[model samples]
Target chain A: MAGSSVSWSERAVRLLRRMNSFYSAGSSRCQCWHFSVGGMEVGLVPPAVLKQLRRFPEVFSFKEEKRLELNPGLASYHDRSSAVDRVLQRLREEERFTCLQGWRDEKYEVMPQFSDPPLMCMERAATSLFGVKRYGVHVNGFTRQPDGQLAMWVARRSLSKQTYPGLLDNMVAGGIGSQKGIRDTLIKECAEEASIPECIAAAARPVGTVSYTYEDGEGVFAECQFVFDLEVSSDFSPSVGDGEVHQFYLWPIEKVKDALVTEEFKQNCALVVLDFLIRHSYLHPDTEPNYLELVVGLHRPL
Target chain B: MAGSSVSWSERAVRLLRRMNSFYSAGSSRCQCWHFSVGGMEVGLVPPAVLKQLRRFPEVFSFKEEKRLELNPGLASYHDRSSAVDRVLQRLREEERFTCLQGWRDEKYEVMPQFSDPPLMCMERAATSLFGVKRYGVHVNGFTRQPDGQLAMWVARRSLSKQTYPGLLDNMVAGGIGSQKGIRDTLIKECAEEASIPECIAAAARPVGTVSYTYEDGEGVFAECQFVFDLEVSSDFSPSVGDGEVHQFYLWPIEKVKDALVTEEFKQNCALVVLDFLIRHSYLHPDTEPNYLELVVGLHRPL
Candidate 1:
């Protein structure tokens, strides 16, 4: 929030504020419905989504903070049982909302559970007004040459894809769907996106994450990407196993950096690449002007 | 700032807030000097330090946001010039201030400039009353057995050392001193702390960083450790190259994890090891409940 000699323009500030805003700033003025967990408001989802939830009267209730509560009593109908997910699926299909990313078992992380599992995953939560946490895994695939040069395998999304059609992507990237955990989803994506074998896929290191809560056209996006790095043998070559990606290109690290400056890479993939460059020593505090700001800004506070 | 079901006690909250309070939390009420870069206020330092800083009026000045600017003109001195360092040295020698961590050429990292080097190194800016970014290299030293079980080499600081005496530490850790760049400093520390040869030290991969701003009796500390991971050969044994370490112990990663929960490891070393654990897949997201949090919290914003 503190501006310095940087001197960002009003337009740039507004764009940044739009991309980084978590709850609608000055939410008190907005007629929004709060999304709560264990009686605390985490977010204020769009009111239209609340209107749709009216059908499930027994599952949700309104209270303080203009809050909408997911009743603990509904735990009996875990989404795994197709109870609540079934209702959301019906709404997606019947109402024909464009936001539904299909009937995948997407689990929206709610509260922390020590010994036991979370009460339930928020199925179809991303497109909802709720500020439920969604997890994803992004893998940086690279190979080191005998001469010590590093080359990364980058993916180009198919034009037919729903989001960011034909955009450039990391070697492998996918959501941590309810069907699989973070690592599992990563391994699955590695296989599906780049045909990386299971043994090699498991070698991917969980480096860290880049989290941000921004509002898009759909709703609030409180996304946290658990990043990983996979160093494939120089002899290995990747072939797309899934139709999601159009093709793969192995570019020198320098080329990747150039693309990063341009708008050639997908939005989030650029951040992942920046993280990779930092860890690999390609980028250093002394070598990067906005070193501290870039590092902290990639993982901003919600 | 929003607390949910994840509520900590007032004491725990204070401890966390103190350690992570990099940004001014509407702390405009407090009378303090702002440390800015570009046009941004990175931190607010105590006035007592400002009073001390007044001795070298050429180095720092006050402006906006109650701002104290590290004069760009002083960058020409590089703190290598005895003129500025001598004054600070004298103050440290005569004042009997508990915060001085002794004289060293600390790298005060500034903007990137390939054409010319940074203006000046921190040159012992850490223990100063003003909060400036302090950089260090923390290496997670470990060996992989034939059976694939991982064990880490832990260093016990020599009881006579200046700080955290007798406390457990990473296999190698040291400040990015003014004399050398980050990589050179790490290589030097590896040699000085663990007799690791230049060839082996070069193999250490530059990982990411972990940042935190904490307030202690020593004024305010805004620290960022450029982390590294070195997979030492199984045959190699580490011996104390200097008197900084009392002894070295090679313990199972699990044992290290157990000790992490206790006070056996120094506050910061535990975090470095945790970062290693996550990277090595020893502490996985699926098994560890605070897995996501631990990863994100380790690399805090600013």
Candidate 2:
């Protein structure tokens, strides 16, 4: 539906393939070493990053199994957290990586799974460098027209943003930083990103998640977004808030689908929007030949 | 949350593990040979089934690379289909397998993906013998009470049914026989299984799909289900039709969650219902620790 020569499904698959580059078979990224902490494999370390870790012998270890792990002597959560933070701060001072240039003070929990107690917390911006599974909440805000058609609320990221500046995004999205709760993060993001009140934001239903892992020049990004769908009233309109967004538009679902394959949206945000379309039945199996593929691709192993 | 001793996430993970038994690490099933057709790997063959196929030298070929393929001499789709069906028919007559005893005069398309041109078609009942992928359509019929609570219509399979007899099921479900389209099968199943009218059944929205592969005593079942959600008016109630269902019950969402872990519903059908619960947010990420795992489990690579 989006391309004249290629079908929408092919375009969508291409987008997902881009987001899951690391998982591509036979790629060098597929050979990344497992990153473990406190006996739990929580992240992936590419060969290049592993080479850099060899320098921090006191804090890092390259075991016989080819795994990159923190020093077993750093037992307590506090000790591990500070040990990793020190290495990251020194790397930032040395200007060792371009991703470190966008460093934020935010912290993220490092664990095998979201519910498990974190072995430790690390700077949010550096999580990808270690390939730790990152979590975020994304809200699909939509309204039902009187004719029963659906329209989604789309946001334009601020030009001043560190990543994906000026690109299209979901109406509400924010990382689930350390000590943060999922729903509370969703509600807070809805208010900060789109000026939605707490009562309205509370209505955002936890639909599911969209997960994918890709490696760029910076590091590997393996992320799982807690997806929500909020059916806002037709009379409501969102205004930009927190200066993170430059503009807001209420576009028909068809327009959103067309934009998905054109790179008009931020890469991962497009995936979140694609998930919303599938769940709402805008992309039916009959029209989209890759319906099942698209569904499975959106939730590839994180 | 069904288990008092274990969390809902654990129970849900156990259910998914059961459905995806063949994918478990280091299991004998993980070593099943790739079953190929026309150079494409469309199915999987366990050692036991591979041994049986070797008896029919003219129909199946066991290559030096360990791949089990339909004889390449059967060049065309028609030739390939008839050749495989012949072996299945003989196996049925010889009482070689229990699954073939449920043989219906139905056929299923076999290919690498759902949208691809079929390499061949095989007896629906005997497909699992070669671990070929099978497809079906499942509908989640529900109604919103005046108080805003959601309830679902659940069917009890007729005692005379060949599979999972007298067990709980979705309001409507049916295998996608060759030449039948997904939405058409969904509408047809809705009318036949729940006595829902065409006009109402047409409202069923194709939300997404649930896929899994499991090995059992008979063989391997690799299945993908096109899932639909139909929200009926509160005044409408379903009655049994076609004698496939013995009775129907309108259950609250919570009741359905409880039944999922109890195995009250057929194994695969319960997965479809669990998917509905997740899409509708009856199972929140906060309470369901296995939320991400459950989401990924439902859409495992087929």
Candidate 3:
């Protein structure tokens, strides 16, 4: 077992070297990851495992490099070296290990497959690889009602998951994992999170793709996000998904500003969705020139 | 001998797979190499090798890919994989047989240090990879001259080269692989090709990067180009590199346009360089509004 662990460590190092060589040759900028978030220690995560974490925000934050540590529970799995070692160890030692059978069940619908080592590496390093593909619709304008202004639909995430859990997120944000297209993911996630009908989701037009990197206490995460803006009636009501979401709310452009400024909205959720709104002129640029500029400028680099 | 050939072929396949996987995962868009250019076959050059080509286009294009096919004496090297296999067999048969020592010494300066199997495979496959990198820059209007016309510095590429040899190209243009930084490469190439002094090159402001894929009989090629717009005095005289260039001329915007359209300048060279001028409004937008719009819109999708 010790010899096997040593071999796995050597293999992990080799994989990392290959990855580094590939990245260095290309011009695309790469972000680094530290394992833990805030005051947590996450050193148990192998460097190769942590390397994959750089792609998702739910798991990593580049800006929080120094504070990145390991999850304490991962210490037992440290010497295992290979990902398979850890998985097999868990199966033998834990009662709930049998429940993890779903991870290997290819027969299950909508479940991710983990048969390939490199792919499994991507899955275990969940945050960076969790870019959900979705369709974006840019609505031109909205009308104000007596009580509130009518605009398109958007959603806030349930805080239970990882990173920015309870924050207001995309109107329809999702991760584009293996075997899923952006359009299909959008439709599925929107339906699950907002109770939006599949037909309406299908009608959503894609504007373009926006990629960004966000770092926090978790680890450095990258997102190749698809932004969609949709127009719904003023009388429309939202039904939140009990499984994926905590609640849903409709805000006028004015109220959105307050929600965004306060901690109500997730990191840049308001900015990205609002930028799409202003670019298509869905909201009056004059009322919130500063917000429009901020959002639009965020899409561009200096 | 047959075993060695099979091993080399397997290595080539492995390298190709790795290249394909890397590009698909990271780049915005990528096209596979399926055509041969000059003497080289396609889909053999790895990203590192491609980057090497971009750096020293003069050496790589002139000596490596270009000379291998265009030079009749070297034409014997063109039997594809079978020819490579035979060459390896010959090297094995004659223990003292060293492979092209003279050619190796000549190309050593520009050739990147790569490993054996992949490097050998790249040499045999004759493939080229091309793509675009976006270096976004904001351009303001250009200054006009006292002669009642817009004065522009037209650059001439080194004459001792391939493709539009000795003709005017851009205010400045060079391959990205010339050096580490785009700014540094542009400065060096401009200084060498057009005789723009180091002091002036230092002041040049970057406009943007233009990426394009070009394929001819030689091979598939990709270029990540950076263009800059600098203000030069109307009376500014350039000291051209006599060995590589004949002279440099500062022309009125009108003469430049006529030269570009009439093929008085090299074909497409005028169109591309002139398009940059128009897109940035260095030329009068009202008089050439259509031309301006066309060029600006050309880069929108990219």
Predictions: Cα RMSD each:
7.1, 1.8, 20.5
Compared with the true structure, what per-residue lDDT tens digits does model 2 show for residues A1-302? 44479877788899998898888875557567888999999998877778778889999998876788899999999999999999999999999888887889999999999989999999988988889999999999899998999999999999999989999999889999999999989989988988999999999999999999988888899999999999999999889889999999999999999887886789899999999999988888977899888898899878
Count clashing residue pairs per candidate: 8, 0, 42
lDDT of 3 by residue, B51-158 (tens): 334433322342333222122232332333334434434433544222222112111101111110111222212223222111211111133687655666665556
**Best by the lDDT measure:** 2
> If both were scored by lDDT, which would come out higher, candidate 1 or candidate 2?
2
What is the full ranking by lDDT, best candidate first?
A: 2, 1, 3
lDDT of 1 by residue, A118-176 (tens): 44566644434565656689999999988899999899998888778888899999987
Task: Give the true-contact fraction for every prediction, in order.
Answer: 0.41, 0.80, 0.00
Model 2 Cα lDDT, one tens digit per residue, B1-302: 34488766677789999998888885557568888999999988877777778899998887876788788999999999999888988889988889989999899999999999999999998888888899999999999998999999999999998889999999999999888899889888888888899999999999999999888878889999999999999899888999999999999989988887776778898899999999988889987888999999999988
Off by over 4 Å in 3: A1-121, A128-152, A159-165, A282-302, B1-302
Q: Which prediction has more favorable TM-score, 1 or 2?
A: 2
Clashing pairs for predicted structure model 2, backbone only: none
Candidate 2's error at A261, in angstroms? 1.5
Number of the top DockQ candidate: 2
Ranked by TM-score, the better of candidates 2 and 3 is 2
Q: List iRMS (one decimal) for every candidate.
A: 3.3, 0.7, 16.9
